[model samples]
Target chain A: MKKINIKFWFVGLILVSFLSCSDNETETLFPDAPANRAAQRNAELLDLLLSQPNGFKGVYFTKNDEFGGFTYYLRFNADGTVDMTSDFDTETAVESSSYEVRLGTTTELVFTTRNHIQKVSDPSYQPLIGTGFKGTSVFQYFTNDNGTITLRDIRNRDSGTLVLTPANFSNFETESVASVETSLANRDAFINSTAVTAFPFLSVEAGGNLTEFALNYDGVRLFANPTKFNDDGSIADEEFGIAFTEDGLIISPALDVDGVLINEFTFDGSSGFEYVATKEGVTAKIGYGNAPVTPLDAYAFGVRATAGVFNMDERFKSSTAFNNFYDAFAEFLLNTYSVVVGNVVFWDLNNGGQPYIEFITNAGRFWWDLDFEVTNGIVVFTPTGNTNASAGVTAIFQPLLDAFIGAPSGYYLLNTGTYLNFSNRTYSMINVDDPTMTINYWDFSY
Target chain B: MKKYTYIVFAFMILAFAMACDDGSDAVGESQIDTTPPILNDLDVWLRGNFVSPYNIEILYKWDINDTDIDRFLHPPFESSVRPVAEALQKAWIEPYTQVGGENFIKKIAPRQFTLVGSFNFNPNSPTITLGLAEAGTKITLFNIDFLDFTNINDIKRPLKTVHHEYGHILNQNIPFDVTYGEINPADYTAQWFNRSDAEARELGYITAYGSSQAGEDFVEMVSEMLTNSKEDFDAIVESISDEESKGIIRQKEAMVVDYYKTNFGIDLYELQALTEAATQELVN
Candidate 1:
């Protein structure tokens, strides 16, 4: 009986201790509840977004490698609506739309209605069919400093990073369109004019490293890629989205090279069209040169491998030596076979790693294969093979084909001075034997 | 004494365990948002035009939760919202009210309207979704950005959708005669897009999509009749060559008119005329 009573007392004491332990309070890191904390954070962000009296200069980056960035002037009102204008082609008209700051995985700033900002994300936008810029309107708040806020898009980590900084409202009101016009003019002066015979390249001197970059303008944005071509022959380039200010240009998200940054560039048109980026203690200059700033060997190979044809135009047949030969061939075909030639195309790298020049006619297409090589910044064609041509075609067209092939020195390929990119670019092929025999053909790939 | 000791231990343990809870924790405020949404000028206008009078809510804003997230959909442009909303009022709401009675639309109408800027393109199919209705409570309009008020065709597309979806809403309240589906039961197929609109009409249906199912066929008749002027409708009936198919179509048309009169207390012809006039007013 004494043992039983002792056992009961032991169990009773154990139960009492367990109940007391259950009542013990556990300490929490946050003084407030998680829900309350989230609500508070959302409210703070909403207040901060609405607090900008002068409005915000919003920079939105596209996730895709081909496209880079866009700029917008946004004014957030207390009514959960935002008035927005963008730097996209004569779109200075302000559009008002709704927005909301809500707490999800993180606090988010969502553009609830379609506005100028949504144009970049619109899937039906023609340039980026099925994928419109690959951008997002829902941005998660990342950081907030003095007057600037950084947000990451919620769709994908690399979808975009929207950075908002305070802007002078009055200045944006009057000078927005002026700045766009100036940017267009400056772009034309730099690389897109007929008189621009030289290729304009950028030299960035930062952190004791001087890197020469090839410049590519996609009409809407500008990109500077390092001249180093990869083993696969693709140019690994970094795109910088820039917005033109009244004085110069502002590069959004900044260009960082080896831990050194360059953000703004002032236009210098005294000597030639040059943009000097001296901001962030870095000196970068855009200078012009007759020869390409990048290596020539890989570019020529890539162009031939991808696009095998340089279609000839009337200008190529305008020379006396070429004109007589071309006309005689056409007249012969007309008189003999009643066939009319539509186009004469030179395929530097046709099927089987051979070269062929094709004559597309109303009757049928004819090809005469040739031996070719790319050396000394030019492509030389030797009239050796006529495997693709019929016996009758070879007998009648071989002599004309040989004359059209020009001298053994071949043709010197020069940029037409409008664009340097492979797509939508024009290159003038001047005969090595006769300099007067020059013809320009557009890529038309775009 | 031993039994008394056991009982006392049990009582003591029960007392200790019972004392553990004091019920001091109070219920917190609900995390659900209850505050009224902030209204801008457009929102205010929508409230006055749609909500105050008819109890309908127009959601022009892009809320991913309100749509199918898988489909790449966007909100209608702010500039396009009012034009589309006004057209809906004139063509759909006003005409229905005038014919169906003053309080007709208020009692029997979609409560919510969701406006989307981009067309809802299906990933695997060539067909694009123009509009969708959910349980007769909500109607989602797509491709609002392409609405050209100056073009009568553009005005007809959305108005036809409203009338089509509204037809379903009426049927939900009071269904069409079940015998109506029996008129041409053999023609319905999921692959209705394979047939042309002309072929579907020859098979006693109004449109290619109308031949998909009986419910769609009924709504198609309502939508096509209301959107098409009487002259166009008569011309279509006249064009059909098959006597049996034409008779079936005529039988369905009488049922549609009778459905409206008996169920909703509205003359289908009068409502059709009003809607046509309202649509013409937009282009003029």
Candidate 2:
């Protein structure tokens, strides 16, 4: 989950405070109202409130006139957005709503979307609207504080207070999508660069041991010539050459020299040249005149350059190439368990506040350790223990831990203290002789 | 011939002696036997001792045969049927009387009835197969063979079923203020059989099979509510999807509240809380 900006709350508080004091006649009581009194007041209040990073990070409590009470955590961001999470009896439902606080004689806080407002009050309590009851009703602001706000109930007598307290923002953990994209791009680049060298090649050869030659062929020249003759008494000019025509040479019908057909030869930029007349070809030097560079080297360089650009483009364009890696990593952490076995104890660690499975032996007591990496939304656990252990240990703990970590929703690892009455039971350890056993239970009051 | 004559004479004399003995007993007895069992009037005696104010009508139907008894009732014994009868009496019938009062039961009487108990022998079927009120008569019991008097759970099952069916009877007699059309507009169909129980519960129906129609769902909810067993009902609620289930739960709750308020003049929520707490105790 993204961290909410603090400016939203700051602006809200400033508007609320200004509205609360606007009714006071302090300026009018003196003489002619000071020029720019309202503007000056606004600037000073804005500076004081906005200068300090404002955030509404707290648990809110409100009792509906009909539906009893509910608690929610409201997080106000600097971008004028609020994230509100309500933990109902069955599951936690979350909604995001934007608010615009209007400062006048009275603070007017208006929710931008009416649908976002959950009418906490029971419908029956309200007067019927046609066949059914009214869906929503609003309240006026009565008081405001750093961590709490009280709203004046127009429909009821007593003022309803909405208390806000700091909550563990880290609890709302979700995987970040950006990190996955970067890693995939890097992988593509490495593959493309290595593939250029092994690209398939083809070549040709000409006549005899004229070891070097230079001529202007296709606006370029080369000066290496090798000449040889076949056993058939036909001259085999095995040489590399640059062709002036786009369709260089046809190897089917042998090229005739003075109306006498010599032999057939294929051309490839690599392997220099070969004699077509010889059953087991002979090598010859062939060169293109004034050629900028070898065809093979030029093509290889171009391939490398294209590969580099392709990688760059992929890194920016394809989210799957990089983002998938992070997504998979997050998924893996959610599913696996870490088992740590010591000489005496074994520990199995998992995610989602589940109890750590602890096993004790003569050597020590092992427990499952849970650690959350909030920024990455990853939970890591290492199953470390005595290396020289029986296979039974792994077989016993691994599968059970795996099932717990992979269980679907509604399966939560709540603190045992929440449901189990610990005061009634006696705690004991197996290996340790000490009779005095201590257990630390968590209290999730907020 | 002489031996035959002697035998015939002896037979006649014996017959005459037996006749004389039968006639002499009435003349010999002088005392009027008035003594009852140590736990005299046991049915009334037991009812008086218990604090439960529910007047359970135990209808005895002797139509069940031995074969049907074996199939339906565990431990197919005449003596075993009593416990099941008693459990149904206490769990549902008695509780309804206590909550709704004797007048309520009277309005729906004949409070208790008995059948020949020979025609039907299966205890489970006798309890579930017969409709509570058919053609203006509420048939509480059919055959004793269909009930396992010893198993408290089995006894409670029919009792709950009857109560649920009775709720329907009452609702039909004196219409509830529930605007059923507004709650759900979709028509129930045979497609309901394909759905899981959770889906039915989420739709505010008691069982997935209840989605077959509005009437069946309503009856199921009533039955489930009266039985007050979380094991029987909580799973149905939990299995429901979040969005669709909430509406169903709320609707059921409202209907229950309205039923109690309009008819029984009792706080339904308070009663529900009590019933829920009791169910939890039984489960734990």
Candidate 3:
């Protein structure tokens, strides 16, 4: 068996002086001072006592007297509590202890439970010492927004003078408390200053035909439309904008059609003005909110009410948001429908009713006709017509038919008959069966 | 008259002695034979006095040759004989039982078999040096080194080898489900061995050495999962290369998950997480 040896060293020195007289002669030097003078001296004494080190808080490192080399750090809280932890096997042995600070000519720190006391030899100045320091052998005084003091043995060569200095506490405090408020104020300023003079709308800007057009702001674009306007003075578009209202911008298409207020738009300093889109009859609400204006913050919003034709391309940059939307839509399609796509697929809005999807597979092309209607927070999808080869309609295309309805308030349909077309190693959107859709397409090769 | 009487008595005594020595009479009928050595004390000491924490039963057989007594008893002195056996039992049997169980020991029953001086080989499985009977008895010509067991941390080779061979024995007794093969397709090969150690580690397997064969690979996975610390396993995974290693790592991970779910009814990910957390605390 091998024995492990450890060395320990005593730290700090205390010096005391005594007054002595040679002879036992009876001599009294002002045995009783005047009452006024005594009162004055007591006041001075109280001021001096208050100035001495009273309590300590920060980090404390303890070395075993028997097994000298191993050191453990105890984190101390401002309320005079210490966290005692073991070096070996942390699962079963970590514990905490409490202490009290006693102030006097010589500062003393008393461990409440064990009655162990140690005098404070070092006084390090800090800016925000929430509580005063008390005498303790190892005292780490940590200020609220200032710094920290590290206590160590001054005598040992390996462990010399306990260093007391301010840590980078300012950085920690700023991040923990002040940063949130700062971000909110910045966001409010940005929204108030940058106003949308011309809202995005479905127009013939590309080729004199109604298609999805994004209103680019500060190089960031939002998918929206100015398709129709309200008879009232307030402008009604993909988003609503009242000249003077609590909500920065309001966009509700349901107000005219359903005669119900399904969405309410509001903005705060923290999250810039947002439109909360909910169902008329139901309690469910889903919409987008802007992020606080900070260099590090990433903005995101949740889609609460997903119905009919909800376009994800309206959320953020096309490259990132569009791909994510497609992925999500693919997953939703797999979960909802049993139809398979093999060859040519076409979206026909020729009759000017609700648009329908026609696809050609090995079993030949089948048309799944749909009727779009918006009610409350939901975009209800209804099927129309009957076409089958057997005794009756073989399969009802309710799921596919439901996918063409209008989305919630924050979102808008890119185009009435916009089809995500994939054919012959090319991906494109055929809008309104127009040939210009092929010209204004996103080419992956580009 | 007295001389004649004496002659007649002598003659009568000689005739009686001659008559008593009949052809059927036996010579020295009170012959004694030495009693065979009573093994009562030895049995009591082995069974009652010496307790195996692993709960293994002890059986003793006298060697006609007397050559194996010193090797089997180990350390030689009569007082230390039981202690040496106890030490060997703790060093080897205890770890096995703790990791496996009493059922494992039972699976390896009586725990002893005779050793032959002559060399023998299995024709079908030429690589197998030792043979175990269906009754849980093993026969080997050579003795295992107890002192060299200190290299238990060498997870790449020796320690892993012992654990793997033992795994085969256990697997043989209680056959694993065939579903284990579905995790990593049958196309998997030791060609992973051709890869550098760095490349293999990235894939999450313990060592490139494991990619040698499917059988060895399976055993390696079991041994590493059961014995090695999480830090050691993680270090190996972190050291692997980016490109060629992911497939191997994915395969190994799937295999380990399957093994735990199929055999022990424990979540492999949860255990791995716990082991990793414990190891991190130690290092930090």
Candidate 4:
């Protein structure tokens, strides 16, 4: 019995060992090794990225609710390098850096080096300060259809979506970079041009749907006050950020007017400053008109009143009627008291919501409170009282101060034009009674 | 029974051999990359100049893993990397080798250097960090992209950081007298940034940052002395108002000089002179 038991025990041990070392059926579940599959996927994704003959064009929104979207052109090389350019800044200069397509939880495309795309995500980028532009350098494959590849930021999937399409290098060169540069130059010219202070409002008609966008001052934002009230018993204003592309301009968060989607518009100055947008065999022509589709007086002035102080422009100081009045006063002050008049600014929602006008001078800044009303298309100002800080300077230049603060009619807040950038525009404050006594001021909120 | 045992043992061996065979002979190559890194001209120069000689690895490319995640930083441009590296070699390494010993940097120095293009801006603080030395093994220099080689002050800024951080490495190797901290313990404060350099000098410190702690105080003295000419350092010492403060600073300076002599047999003043000369030559 003992001999038989020993033989049985040896046989059982061998059986268990063989069973433990055997490969499981799990190998059949996957046709190829996980490592090899991942490597192949990485190669394919890289090939797809480099397959574009010219390059890839992409649009990215820094923040869903904030400054709209930015356009980027990128060319990927197999040698772990990438060339990138953007429409955000005037430089539009191409930047070269390294990139990698590697497998993580999913296939990821990472900008591994400092480039234009990385700058949007860099907190050290000056414009955004500590928060940056709320962008990301690591992107995961989202979709590939109809020659367009969509990559979503892995870290901030909800922040924005970046869609890439095969781009012709020459088209981007001529239409986007050169076009953006031209638009930028024109933007600067528009701001400084005194000949035409009035900018035309854009009327977009898409799929038989008509919507009007008033080109806000600063030249990049289009504002539309609601004609219909919301369920909350409040009228909401829709605003979109606009930027110049290689061939034309793109309006971020493509507007969904009724059922028609209208976002991108092409502009060719060959037939005047005309813009057109097309989608699914339907075309939308954006025509410019002198009068705003939506009246802007109450909306514009009301927003500016509470936004921040309006800084007086040098144009105001140099205008004939206003300059004649102020230059003599400035000369008198400089010749007699040796105190120079610097500039003047208007502030609302200051001093417990009381409107005030401040006269900045070489000696110091002085302020006098005023009562103002935002009427149909203008503001009427009446100086009420002077503060202790203004008492001394006000005693010397009370007449000049009163003339600026107490014009016959308050200033008509007129939109001069918009810039290629979004959010803010420039406005000229013309004396309602005397257009020559005009002051073109910038919004000092930023 | 012995014959039966032999038969069982033979069968067991046969079973083991069968268990080991999986029937597949195709060994897969390791998908993990074993390839050498692609080196540009700047990288080749760095390897030849710093790596082969001193075992130093200069990282000028942007790698988020190599930096503090909370702070905003970037990699130095290829154009900016070589100039700063050359400056470090001329001003810091060559001078130290000449003054201390030929193998001074090769044996006891940071093995890795990280170059950053932008200033290391702190989110919570108003100040920006120019450089950081980690555990005597690594040194990260910031604002290399902004360095104007023609400007003496800008050139001194990073060189000062190198000397200052290296001072800490030396201190780690052979600590300064513990009594050094007791010299002005009452003056050290966490709120050093609130105090101006003039005020710190009046309180027996070379810089406001030196007033934070004893280790920083020693390093700041090393940095300030090495970066500035002997005349400038003396002028600063003389500018202090209180006679008692001046005496205390003189005492600290004496300990520093003595620390080098008794510990490493190095003339601190000679190293400082060589450093200053190298730095001046660099800008000129």
Candidate 5:
């Protein structure tokens, strides 16, 4: 989750002595067992107030009149941080710091969220720190009452009577769409993973009736909000909302030009994503992140120095060549992935918050010592525990984990015939013959 | 046999003589094929596990034998069947057997249990019947698919439903004190779900569902006492600000205890503790 950023240096000086409340730093300890039955009931109430409700876990809800009357949700994960999502849009305002759940009074449950903002439009930015929250929010639970629970925004006076419903079996412990924050996060990861942000214009196939035009088009800015750039000069704009799928990338509906959205941009990997507005006779291949060094400079997919395909404008060869070098290369990469497991360059580990990978296998459900790495656009599991013949399995699946860990972007690791992990967090095997299969994923690191 | 034949022939002749009738009546036909739907292994398990011990039958498969044919309902998921059965065993059946003896339940328990996956909702009246005990013989429970066996709250509510329905069954068999209904009879309304719990409690009812009627109120009071600890029940009674409402709740609590003791030879408080401990295993 990202954090909110405002002009906080000056604001901090002004309110340095403001946040000195005794309840600010609450204990994170689980309560001890109750002595009697009545105490047991009290302890149960406290437990619900404290722990992540089992099965659709780490999902929290809040309502505020900050933007009129709207209800937003927070995805409080295993990291103890909260991701506050917008009700009107997919924009998520994440907590600047971690949140804590503490007993406000004998009866009330208080959850505090510090200010931070990670625009749902942009998933790449490191959240900026904010001044503070507007005011404290209060949550209370009542049984056999009007509703199961409620949250009141003390600042805005918007009261939300919450209904946390239990989902069915397969959805157990999975991210919920009803909890908007996690849904957006999950959606963003999927979209960005499919290289949505990578494609700016993609490909334009023009055939109806075309005329020659000069290629002086540098000042044409497409997406809004200049956010940041990686060390390799990759741009991260805060206003680019995307939806990625197995087929192609889906841009926000608002990006449509005259009711023609470049909805399906299939990045064939050799060239850039090829997009065409239907009936427009305009097909163009797009590239990722920032615009080219020069407006007319050719943008190619990993092959800029050699002979490449020309970026066409009207009936003219306007910009750089997009080489067909990766077309056969992408297919070749998919075929020998099992062999490429040991050939990985590096494992980019998710360092903070101890995000676990549940390896539910014949090796006997290892969860304690776990880590994840994203390399070549695929997620992989790396557990410290040795899992092999001792726990009762013939062949070790460490190579498979290596393959999954090294699976590049837009590819996932499954046994011989498994479908795409639709939620994407979970990975499983299709072959019953394989000894170890099915790994449940909980990604605390963005 | 000869005398009967002679009488029959004389009667037939007399009837033929008296008949000035045209043949218009047609006999009602029947679809007479009698291959019963093959009951599966769940039935075999139920017979071995429940029926042989207590003469109880468990039905989880779709059966139109005695159901409302037009109502939309489905069977529990195959995976949920055993977990639900185990939870039923742990929470309801075993506790009763321990407290009231094996013979006690064998003599008085419902003979059949029907499980459904979804709630039986009535569109005309906004009420969903979670459990129904029919004539002290069968108890039907809905939403078994949603029950998470590891969680106490999930198991407790169904057990509460079982206990409440069984209370009704017991009432039907031996009946409660008539004065139990005569305590506070004015606020009983069929539209009980419309009112809030606070409003219901203020009006001298334990829950909104209890305010449905005197009969439901009695069972609800009994179920609450059996399922909840003394402290929890005391909190509810104490939370009611009105003194008269408090007094009424106390009276209902006393009558429930008396009903359990005088009829079943069971101490209500001890039963509550036992039930609480059994359920605590599911959660803790």
Candidate 6:
């Protein structure tokens, strides 16, 4: 299926080209072979090529003995120029370049293009890589039985076969219907539209620094999310309209900033897309994508808090006042949510080891429930507490411990085994209760 | 009416002759490939940057029939090409032009460079070829696919090839002294690959392949002297155990140094230092 698709891609919108279409040997093409006409042999062949019907498509087929199969499309203009498009074959058919046609035993036309490399299948072809460096394909065209033109590509002993005939794609009319204001009301129908595609957006700054963004299109709209560095470029909120021109689908209208057009979403349904943005003579190419990417997930915050302490500030000047504040805060936290404090969330009951790890983030997984010493590390529970008491609330906080034993964070013995990559990350926020006492809280990504 | 009847009769016969005559059915002259050569940005880079200045054309497109088609090969990615080009301009071309004077390389340099991405593995032997200098006009370089312009060693591989091939080209332009090769004539062999670099060094040869032929040895000495640090060459000479073999290598080095001064009005040591600095700029 992939092979067939690639071939269809190469033999793009075929147009038939032929020298003569005759079923018999005794055929006269020039209705009136005028006596005044000179022997304009090559000119006559050119006339035959140019006089084809308006929608006549010409296709060149080459079965390269070394480099597999390939095709090129040639459509001649009345003004002596040939427009060509190609599927990359043994030789690339230079687009919008003039091709040569001449009269001999068979007609000869040479196709030329840059940005092409000849790939071959024969083992013998490997040794001469640096020797032959011709960037053109010289083909000799012959009229075969039944009027089909067979062209033999005589470049580099490649012996590639080129067949030219009248060609048409049955669905050209349907494919040409690029845009209709369908104004899709829902996601499913819009996403399933044949035109919708994920285009990898390449953004070039005003000075020429390039970055990539995956512009994913659902049925109704195309979206570019906030990247790790820049949050303002969320295309869902920013993109204003979709207008599909003959060139392609322009999802966002061109926006001008400081006299330079910057954020405009436009893509032709090809392997790549380019549009002028931010710079007049410079257009950035956003690569076309066939695969949808996984969206970045936002981190969820749990009702967790950690209170920072100082030795003796003026606000917490009295020991009795500090005790009262601590009791109230600890009670509020424990009742409301799962809170583990003092850096270490869990200490193994048997080994008493703290789980400290660098952010490789792929910590091991577990589902076993075991005793964990969770803490708020507050000395609030002491009766009129001694000023120099060793500690209070050092034992397991059963409620917090029970809530997360089988969960991801509780299961991983940090610094052991493989690690899990993150789902999301959140910034750490600190809430000040008073000047001296602040609660710093954060949620984990993994 | 009698004169008009004769004119009409003559026109009819001519029309009939034109319509019926189909001998040979030849239409026009022999076909000439009339299409103009295609020039992309890479071609422009080679022309405006290198060829326009130095009269050289760099062929990076993988021409398979021109390549060793028996081996699996690919061209350097389009993005990967410019770095090597820029590096060549910096390390080899610019430095030579700087040292030998601007018009020096412009007057005598290889006109074409064929870049092959994969190393041209010798099918007959274990040793891989870095490049080939064709009749002093063209140079073919292998291992372009793996050229990291940022890596000194990677840059050195091709830089070395260019200098080595340039040596051959220079020799072809004004042949090198034959007496330089006579110093180590008995050590030369076709089995240059059989020995290791270290073994060849012990045998008073700079590289294993340098021992293959005298012409190669002289150029190898030229390329090695220009690419490697002076200390590195001195270290190699110092490592060799045999006194007579060492003396022969010293003689050959002196001859190469003298050939540069006498023929090209260049100091080989100065060119080596310039190339070394250019290579360091890439990494640093």
Indicate the DockQ of the complex predicted as candidate 6: 0.04
- DockQ of all predictions against the true structure, Cα-based: 0.31, 0.00, 0.01, 0.30, 0.01, 0.04
* lDDT against the true structure, each candidate: 0.73, 0.37, 0.33, 0.71, 0.48, 0.49
Q: For model 5, how big is the iRMS in angstroms?
A: 32.4
Q: State the lDDT at B273 in candidate 3.
A: 45
Residues A1-446, candidate 3, lDDT per residue (tens digit)? 11121111111111111112123447856644344344434333323222223222122222211111111223334544434332111221324444433322222232332111111111111210110011223222112222333333322213222222222233422231232233223323322333211122222212232222232222111113333333453443333221112222223222332344533333433432223333444221112212111111111111211112223333222223233434564565456654343422323333344445454434456665555443322223344664332322233333232222212221221222232552212122211111111111111111
Candidate 4 chain A minimal-lDDT segment of 10 residues:
A219-228
Q: Which predicted model would earn the best DockQ?
A: 1
Q: Per-residue CA lDDT of candidate 1, range A1-446, in tens?
A: 97987988788798757867574677778987777788888988888888876578776775534455666778888877788777654656777788999876799998988887887767677755545665666788988988689888776555468888887567655554454455545544444443343345667776677766666445443444435455687776656555554456655456776677877678776765567887555688755544456754323522533233343443431333345456677898899889787776665553355566777778778887677676876777776665666888767766656555655677667655333333454565556655445445554321
Indicate whether candidate 3 or candidate 6 has the larger DockQ. Answer: 6
TM-score of chain A of each: 0.62, 0.25, 0.23, 0.58, 0.23, 0.26
Better of 1 and 4 by lDDT: 1
Considering the two chains of model 3, state its CAPRI-style docking category.
incorrect
- Misplaced by over 4 Å in model 3 are A1-446, B1-104, B107-110, B113-143, B146-162, B182-209, B242-247, B250-254, B257-284
Candidate 1's iRMSD: 2.5
Question: Model 4 Cα displacement at A412 (Å)?
Answer: 5.1
A431 Cα displacement, candidate 6 (Å): 71
- Give the TM-score of chain B in candidate 5: 0.83
Which candidate achieves the best lDDT against the true structure? 1
Q: Model 4 off-target regions past 4 Å?
A: A2-24, A27-31, A60-66, A77-81, A93-115, A118-127, A130-157, A160-163, A170-176, A179-231, A235-243, A247-377, A380-446, B1-21, B24-27
- Give the candidate order by descending lDDT: 1, 4, 6, 5, 2, 3
User: Residues B31-150, candidate 4, lDDT per residue (tens digit)?
Assistant: 674557666677789999999999999987766556775555555556788889989999899988887788988989999999877777767776778889999999999878889999
